[model samples]
Target: MASVLDAGPFFHGTVAALQAGDLLTAGYRSNYRPDIVMNHIYFTALVDGAGLAAELAAELVKGVAEPHVYEVEPTGPFENDPNVTDKKFPGNPTRSYRSVAPLRVVREIADWTRLTPEALQMWRERLSALSANPDARIIN
Candidate 1:
C-alpha cells in the first residue's frame, strides 16, 4: 500500500490545465490530441512537499490564494515503480497521462505535512533559477 506522503500534491484548475498541456506536449514532446483535457495540472515533486505545491498552483491562477489540492496515489506496479529509465511514457505513448492513480482531496491542508519557512525559501530560490519565466510570480 502506498502511504499518503508518497503521493505528491496537485492543483486542478484552468491554469493547471494550460500548464499540463504545455508539459505534455512541449516538455514531454508528446503528440497533441484534441481529447486531452486541458483544465488541470499535477506536480510530482516530493522533495518540495505540499506547501510548495500549493504555492506553485496559486502562482498559475491569479487572485486565487488557496487552490483546491489533492493527493494522487499509485494503484499498480507500473505506476508505483520509479522511472529508472527516465522515459516520458512507459507502456503506451498514447496513454502517457494514464499513469496517475486516483486522487483524494486534503480537506485540512494545515494538518498535512508542509514545508518549513527555510525549506520554502530554498525551494523558491531553486525554482526561480529553473523557471523559464523569471519575472513570473511563483508564490502568492
Candidate 2:
C-alpha cells in the first residue's frame, strides 16, 4: 500500500455533481484519453490546481457542463501522482496525488480562479493538438 506523505486540505475536480460525504473512485475516462479507463482517483492540495482540472473536465462539454471543485479526504493511503510528479519534473510541485481507494467529498469550493474565455479557448486548442498527436500521453 502507498503511504500518505503529505498533510493536505485536499481537493478533487470534476464535472459530476456530488454532495458532501460522497465517495469518488477510479475507473473513469478522461477527455484527454477517452480510450483508457483510469485506475486511480486524483486530487491536489492546491485549490486552483484542482480548478484547472475541473475546467478541463468541463471543457469536454463545450460550456454545457459545470466544473466543480470539492474539498476531499482520502479514505485510504495515497502516493504522489506519477502523471505529474515525475516524467519531466523532479518532485510533487503540483501537490498532486492519486489513490486506488475512494476520496470522500467534504464540500464544494467556490472561490478558485476560473480561466478567462480566451484562456480556456487557448487550452482547448492545445488539447485538440495534443489529442491529434500520438505521443501526448497520459502517464497513467
Instruction: Give the candidate number with the greatest TM-score.
Output: 2
What is the per-residue lDDT of model 2 for residues 62-107, given as tens digits with 9 covering 90 to 100?
6688999999999988888887787657888899999999999999
Which parts of model 2 are misplaced by more than 4 Å?
1-3
- Against the true structure, what is each candidate's TM-score? 0.36, 0.90
For 1-140, candidate 1 gives per-residue lDDT tens digits of 65443333432221132221222211221111212232322334342333455555454444755543333333432232222113434543222122433333333333444556687578566655645454532110
Q: Each prediction's Cα lDDT score?
A: 0.35, 0.88
Q: Candidate 1, TM-score vs. the true structure?
A: 0.36
In candidate 1, residue 27 scores what lDDT? 23
